[model samples]
Target: MTSVVTAGGVSVTMRGPVVDEAEAVLDRLVTDGVPASLMAKNAQLWGPEAVEEASRRLGWLDLPETSRPLLPELAALVERVRADGLDRVVLAGMGGSSLAPEVITRTAGAELTVLDTTDPQQVASVVADRLERTVVVVSSKSGGTIETDSHRRVFEQAFRDAGITGEDLARRFVVVTDPGSPLEKTAREAGYTVVLADPDVGGRYSALTAFGLVPSALAGVDVARLLDEAAALVPALHQPYDNPGLALGAALGASALGGRDKLVIADHGSGITGFGDWAEQLIAESTGKEGKGILPVVVEGPDAPGFAEAEDVRRVLLGARPEDSGLGVSGPLGAQFLLWEYATAVAGRVLGINPFDQPNVQESKDNTAALLRGAAEGEAPTVVAGEPALVVGAVEVHAPAELLRGATDLTGVLEAVVAAIPEHGYLAVMAYLDRFADAGAERLRPLLAQATERLRKTPAAVTFGWGPRFLHSTGQYHKGGPRNGVFLQITGESAQDVPVPGKPYTLRSLQLAQAFGDLRALRSRGRPAVRLHLRDRAAGVEQLLSALA
Candidate 1:
């Protein structure tokens, strides 16, 4: 039987054998006062003081209550932007720094574009037309994120190209970062407006703070109302079974423990589609470490194209009501943000893991840095030419026979890879092609469906995302989380390439480097991963679809 819980205009429908256990866990959490303790800064429940030191960064727990008071200041900033006629915003960030703002802009109709990807074409596509009126928001918690820094550098040059320099350029820029961080120092020196984020809040949890709200305010969203609605969930945090956050978190942890580890979040007309991206980073980074984690698969709808079908998947439906229009958008989204944050913390407790730390996410970053520094010394990706296609890396060849054996074409390689996933494992289909290649990516859905049917024998999950983008988002969870993933990296030759302003490499080169770097990082960790490169986007997707058929 399916169980449904509705709160604050948001509904969570959970179905699985672990539903009861999740409820029990929620009850225990309430009885133990876990949520309240966390809010009270009780770090002992998480783990040793050292192991869970990050847990003390719980200022986000009070953001809704605390940030409500800042609405006037935020509104003033927004008014200034409007008065200055700044019509567009280009947010330069990565992961936690970017996802929440992206959601706010999407749901609130903010005239803002998030530049979280380092792909040159993506960067060009964003700033090409709006360079004159766009205000660049350089957001980063550490202030030294490689991708954010790269984006800032590129856009700074773009601003200069548009003849906006010195005080003018500073007027067109804002910096959201912690006090004394490199970005704050740089922004102060450059005369950019600096919004200091609460140092006690981690990046993934900073949604209610300036990292998320400033952009929301700039986008014309009602920050005061959003905070007020978000604050409503505060009282429920102390409750046990009736609390939405505790219930949802227990379900997530219990489901994973029961073998349904894939959390497929289905957003059905919720106006919060971008919430999935934010939730993905929150859940993945917080709990995906210490060789255990829950996989979050955010889909548009249950019927979304290329949606994963597997027994290990537990669907979480985010449904919207007809009355939920305009400012009402904040109600559901704000509640969800708080719900998931609380639930992730509870789930971490259930899993006996520290919810605040991300230990494995740095491996890929380190590897990418090594590759960029030319310090990555290893064998190049092995290549094999076949009919109308070429296989790069040993991903498919190294896959289980059930997944790849008896294959007659390039599609068979994908078939085999999907078939190789264990009952408790998952398939991460990462595409490094253009974001516009949605139709091409959709062609592989039938294959995923077929793989899902096969997965019933053992049960697994499938996830798909565009590259470099996912690198900043799910990339952390994939590398740092549990070792239950079988990775399939897809790449195609770019039709055209754009170069970074002062970098030696083109966007295409950088994309490939990131791909290769991630592959090396995965293999270095002894995880199963493979790669397939197509000659060009069109022909590659077409051939692969044909081969699958």
Candidate 2:
């Protein structure tokens, strides 16, 4: 491993010629004072085009120091909750607002149940937990995330159903949102504990902000130490050379520039659980737009399938140190978070795109909203044009007849998706199933990724994300990034659909709407995409594996 920067007990390293190729670009960025400018929140470093948005999105740069004051508040809140015999912390959030906290709590070995999906089974799984011991943290940057809102409604109803009311019910919720957001307003009126995030910070970059810290601190992670860890890296970030942030940014920018846009991230003992999932959102959402982007393929580990060397793929190690070839980012989670946020901003400048803006993420949400509106109007959701192309076992595969190419079964559908992939292209498997009940579905990513490579005798990458959750992360890349990707959407029928409290639609309906909405978005772009609806999730998964094998 080539060690690039070591700061705050964190080391940035990478092996192979990827960093070597980035050396020249690193020099250019240094000569242009990109690192120092980014630290200063110059905003224009991303060019005049990004200044307006970047100006308001750079608050994360100062979060290390600025967010220190939140520690006592978070600690006090946690104390109160625990004292009240509420030991479970379930976070109701999506994407940027949820991913970081999920990682943080998990790494700390804290029991923080994250509700980041519209899957009814996933919601049901959480709701089935002991409600009397739970305090749900509802987080949303815009205060309008449908999944988060729906989660709050469900949890509130669950609490009320258990005879909790008024202040007791209010105390069961802690809301983290932007100041003056509708959520903050409603949370205050509802007597829920309200913590306002920095208004200038965007959701993805709010790792050090209240969005990430409150839930973590409440769930028993040392928030103060996270800030301190991040603070130690601040000095190095201001320097152009020997900067961990620059080293990472160079690795990312160079890989994307050298036609290696699929970043294979694996945690070979990173001690930090689920960091890649969080980074998946930050990198994919920030850079995957404007037709040029880096797609992060987060693998289970070094042993995970899809780790096979590919010309268009770059390996990234997120362990204690670099044990294999790839860009290695290892440090305390707090510092690592800051490092990546800085690098993403720097890489945005390198790639000539605005890192702060999520132009396409809203489209899928809008589509889901429209579908939900129709559902309320008693109009059938028209996400699919017609019937399934073929049904194999308990799974029904839906695709345009033209794209199916006369495929008769599930294996043919797999072949069709593989056939659609261009040189250096990828396949994305999106599951709109309960990550809890249908957890085994994740195995399909590696299985399919390896299968594609074997079938074509060429390196291919496959990415998996739970639906609606990915809708906020890689969903951006699938719709806005390189069109070289083929999509396979997997959704399951919830045996018992969970209603969204007062909302018109149920959680199962919301999940389908999100899946079909994104499917429509992909097909509209003329992307070779298909939807696999599992009439029986367990049986369908088994059948899918058999076919893939």
Candidate 3:
């Protein structure tokens, strides 16, 4: 742990064993061409105030009082959902409102889905079908999210179409927002029950509040379990080396001085999907200024999988650490963030960019909009197909015997295929090999060095989480970056179809499988790539890695 004086004259220490010598590493990073201005900006973002605010906000005291009057009422609502035979809960909102529920669902492995996009088909499907059986949790701190309102309008129509009207909407729909926000007013006027989000708490930080809790509870997740997990982190905050979150913020802030442009947050599970959005808002809104910001890139692996091969793309920062005894203190979500904070700071300092900004994010949006505009007029983006370039390596085919045995089921079969790949010792990717995170650069650092040593040039290392979300955030980069990576695409076929009870949506397993296929199709064109299909998915992780060899 290193101690530094904040600009406020207060001494704050990041509590963790340093990955490398901080100042020496920082010096070496700058010598490599990191801008000094970025360093100065990060120094300010990680100064006393920012760190203090983060600690407090992430700590126990920042959460609502445990005994608030609404606790039991909230609990009752959740219990009711479970008893009513609902199988999935859908949340509608974008950014902060969307990310919190995502984290909670992931941490608890809840059967809740969050939709933040304005896709009409997606909205129509969920509202037209699921809303009748599954509850809808609409979260908007400002109560004026155009997307949220749009979803609500669609949901209301669905309710009416189902012969469920008026007061019944209050039972099936819930709203989380500040008092008098347009959402609040709409909810009250529309006869929907309201759960107030803390006015003082910003949207990005309201996951632990009503924004995250209501949906989490409805999904049968234990919200209190999450709080207890967070509370357990209190003692660690005061001791510098013991605190993961603070250490992360500091190291990442310090890394921004070094020139690391990407902080990839790699994870799996639908519940955690919102994490990317949360990180997106947090880093983009907080650390973007003074011309230096670290792009918070998030990627996921084989629950969804694809790796990018773009030269202009930046480093990969793996967020998960090996599970430790201390982790028992916090819930999985808390542990995920605590570990991520440390990695984020480390990547920021090494990269010399503030981890709080969205640098390359705009390029994708602009490009996509332009492509859409052209397409609207019956003009499609031009694609010039060249020779098939086998980039990553040849796609290995298991013996007929092995493939047949593996084909009994998707999970197991996929595991066997991946386990065949020899583990690359020097490059440490996320536990799941195929996904990328904002912090993934740290994992790829050694591989990068090795590649640079052999090829005399660096390849862009890009990552995306779940297949659908990546198509939104980094699709443009993958399509446009100078193709130079061995894209590693990983996905699994379903073993048993877990039907959505009475709903026509066969099972989430199929939807996810199809999404992965769509992602693969996007990457296979003009690039040398290999796709491995795992029909049996229950295979163990070690077995999967062995197959990858």
- What are the clash counts of all predictions, listed in order? 3, 0, 83
Could you tell me how far off, in angstroms, the CA of residue 538 lies in candidate 1 after the best superposition?
3.0
RMSD of each: 4.7, 1.4, 11.8
Between candidates 1 and 2, which one is better according to lDDT?
Answer: 2
lDDT by residue (tens digit), candidate 1, 84-173: 888787788878888898887788776677776655556677878667778788899999887777777777887787788888888888
| Tens-place lDDT digits, model 3, residues 440-546 | 32333333323433332332333323333443333333443323223334434333333332223332322333333333343444433334333333343233344
- Tens digits of per-residue lDDT, candidate 2, 120-164, equal 877888998888899899999999888899999988888888899
**Which sections of candidate 1 miss by over 4 Å?**
1-18, 49-52, 304-311, 320-331, 375-408, 437-447, 454-459, 495-506
lDDT of 1 at 361: 68
Candidate that would win on TM-score: 2
> Of models 1 and 3, which has the larger lDDT?
1
How many backbone overlaps does candidate 1 show? 3
Weakest 10 consecutive residues, lDDT, candidate 3? Answer: 322-331
Name the best candidate (by lDDT). 2
Model 1 scores worst on lDDT over the 10 consecutive residues at: 321-330
Of 2 and 3, the candidate ranking higher by TM-score: 2
Ranking by lDDT: 2, 1, 3
